[model samples]
Target: MSGGAMLSLDGVHAVYGRKIRALRGVSLEVRAGEVVALIGNNGAGKTTLMKTIAGLLAPEKGRVTFQGRALSGLPPHEVMRMGLSLVPEGRRIFPRLTVMENLEMGAYSRAHGAELAREYEHVFTLFPVLGRRRAQLGGTLSGGEQQMLAMGRALMAAPKLLMLDEPSMGLAPVVVDKIFEIIARINQEGVTVLLVEQNARRALKAAARAYVLETGEIVSAGDSASLLRDPAVQKAYLGL
Candidate 1:
């Protein structure tokens, strides 16, 4: 609702196959340098909202703005150049490419050289195992490693806002903990994050502010700590 929003969606509505509506007047915002979370059950349009913002799926109505620029019809590549990047639900790495190659692909919008090299070093610092396996094929990395690679690759682009979809999906508990920690550290380094995670408790813990989506609309929103303690949110999402 404020002009200082780093990313804002105003009454966005998206449809699929001319029949199903995935987003119904959804509106939310992530301010500069903040970690925000969107938590919901399956088919709640979490991914669709992320796609709309990333330009993977165009909204049939309403507007998406990043840094005061409207992004309704921009293509995904153009959105990336505007300093917004999305790491989709799965760890969609270039399976055949080596780890280093995958990281290079993240910076496709930029020319190769000193700046890219600096980003590479920063990614390696965040996930040292990735640095160790720089030559390994992406497909061969373990699940946790692949998740790390996904985040690292996105970071390679040096985005101002990074949207992560289910960063903890299908991973062991310990690995999920590590992944959330890395996310926090990434935010500490000045990258604003909008995370969509099914793991509500962990998502709330990692984010400062949060929104709870139900059937394609934001049903509730507040600071993460308060939502964590909310009776309805606890029973429905937190499984308490």
Candidate 2:
């Protein structure tokens, strides 16, 4: 029960240094085995929302509830340990560490003998490139491969809810396709997903529901299929 409807942000407001407002009463939710995308343009508070859910930045107002528990004041590591993980916009991998080491770092809180072995096998299965380059330093991998490593490392946490921010930014079309395919596969295996993407077309296709954020507020939200076809959403986000 706790793993499903995995996270919720209700009437959340986030500010910076008491002057700039980053999020204005934002609200969203993610359910089990579903991919929910939040779409927005630049400076729309997408990254801020992700950081809030991950507990890196606490909301100035409103509630962040995960699995029926209040999440305010919880730290990022605590949130991760509770099965929420984030694969951030920029691939943040330890360049000096080997691919295997990076994956191990993802599991640092709970990595053990058999558990680690299973985690390694599972992550490798998901991102075979990581397995192939297991010995290579993370910094040496190509951009796409680094993205894979970032995702694989996130998976190493055995997260119940995975939040992906700007997953398609700067990747080639083919690499983007591959990443989306993996995201679909991950969802099929029952990991709830909270996806933040600027590529609205691809994201709307993958998610079951979508929310469009602008100037730190949600302008639209509905079933993904409907939102994809909405005249306003099409005009504003899809360029259709």
Q: Top model by TM-score, which number?
A: 1
RMSD in order of candidates:
0.8, 1.9
TM-score of each: 0.98, 0.95
Tell me the lDDT of model 1 at 93.
94
Per-residue lDDT tens digits for candidate 1, residues 163-188, read: 99999999999999999999999999
How many pairs collide in each candidate, listed in order? Answer: 0, 0
Q: What is the lDDT of residue 18 in candidate 2?
A: 62
lDDT of 1: 0.95
Highest lDDT: which candidate? Answer: 1
The residue-by-residue lDDT of candidate 2 on 39-111, one tens digit each, is 9999899999999888988889999998888988799999889899999989888999999899889988884
lDDT of each: 0.95, 0.89
